[model samples]
Target: MSNPAARPWRETKEGIALDVRLTPRGGRDALDGVETLADGRAVLKARVRAAPTEGEANTALIRLLAQEFGLPRSQVTLASGATARLKTIALSGNAAAIATMLETRLGAGRQTG
Candidate 1:
């Protein structure tokens, strides 16, 4: 896992706001782990099977995150970077729980950025 102070997610009013470096058409749908970017920004590494077209990959990402976080699709929304590789995902629910879950899950799947 990356440094705790540099983790890519933060507790928001509703839940957590996550910075993700998404790879569409990534062969398989999975969260690789957490890493710090070249500029020192932390991001979660995630790959989706769906291609980046007609919002398919975005939808797939939402579904993936929702499923990963055990939240409904409605709770997981793209907060920014719709057409870019780096996306900000907003997860709505218990902020603390979601943060803990993200930390635990990402730490378990940790990988170098």
Candidate 2:
């Protein structure tokens, strides 16, 4: 069966590439859910309390994702969109495990409109 996590992430040779829509300077750090863009692309909605300046928001996002995926900070990196709300995150680990984890996590709260 195709992975349900494929909506927000795709398996890569190194690990997985995740698409995220980040909300910087949010009240707290959390993954709101999965959202489908107008272009038919799915993205994870993440929020961090840190401001956008000085890469703090990006740092917070990495930390939050690391915690969520049970990985070290170094395992999660911002692959693109340093200045935009849409971002690509590179996570290094077992692709299957990460995809499973993402599927399980996303299953609880997926929003499409």
Candidate 3:
């Protein structure tokens, strides 16, 4: 069986790549947890209070992630999907350490409906 904790992220030479599903214009910014899609892809569910206009939601997402991972905003970047709800985020740092931090904060395992 695949490790659930590792499902939402992939290790990269520079650090780690994370797949995130964002809910824009949410009442508040928060991490909803890991969600397994119908296609069996796992993504970290997050919400931001900012509206999804002019990249506000995307900026908030990066901020939220930076805070969650205890990293500077400069260390987090949107790797792809800037205009879509599903986004790819790249973090610059130690891959294992970031993975461990993700597991600790978001819990280990995949969440499926």
Question: What's each prediction's TM-score?
Answer: 0.89, 0.90, 0.91
Candidate with best TM-score: 3
lDDT of 2: 0.87
* TM-score-based ranking: 3, 2, 1
Residues 1-113 of candidate 2 have per-residue lDDT tens digits of: 44354378988899999999999988999988888888878899999999999999999999999998788998899999999999999999999998888777776246755
RMSDs, each prediction?
Answer: 2.1, 2.0, 1.9
For model 1, how does the per-residue alpha-carbon lDDT over 33-103 read when each residue is reduced to its tens digit?
78788998788888999999999999999999888878899999999999999999999999888888877
Q: Which residue window of length 10 is worst by lDDT in model 2? A: 1-10
On lDDT, who's better, 1 or 3?
Answer: 3
In order of lDDT, best first, we have 3, 2, 1
State, as a TM-score between 0 and 1, how close model 3 is to the true structure: 0.91
Task: Output the TM-score of candidate 2.
Answer: 0.90
The Cα local distance difference test for each model comes to 0.86, 0.87, 0.88
Superposed by TM-score, candidate 3 places the C-alpha of residue 99 at a distance from the truth, in angstroms, of 0.9
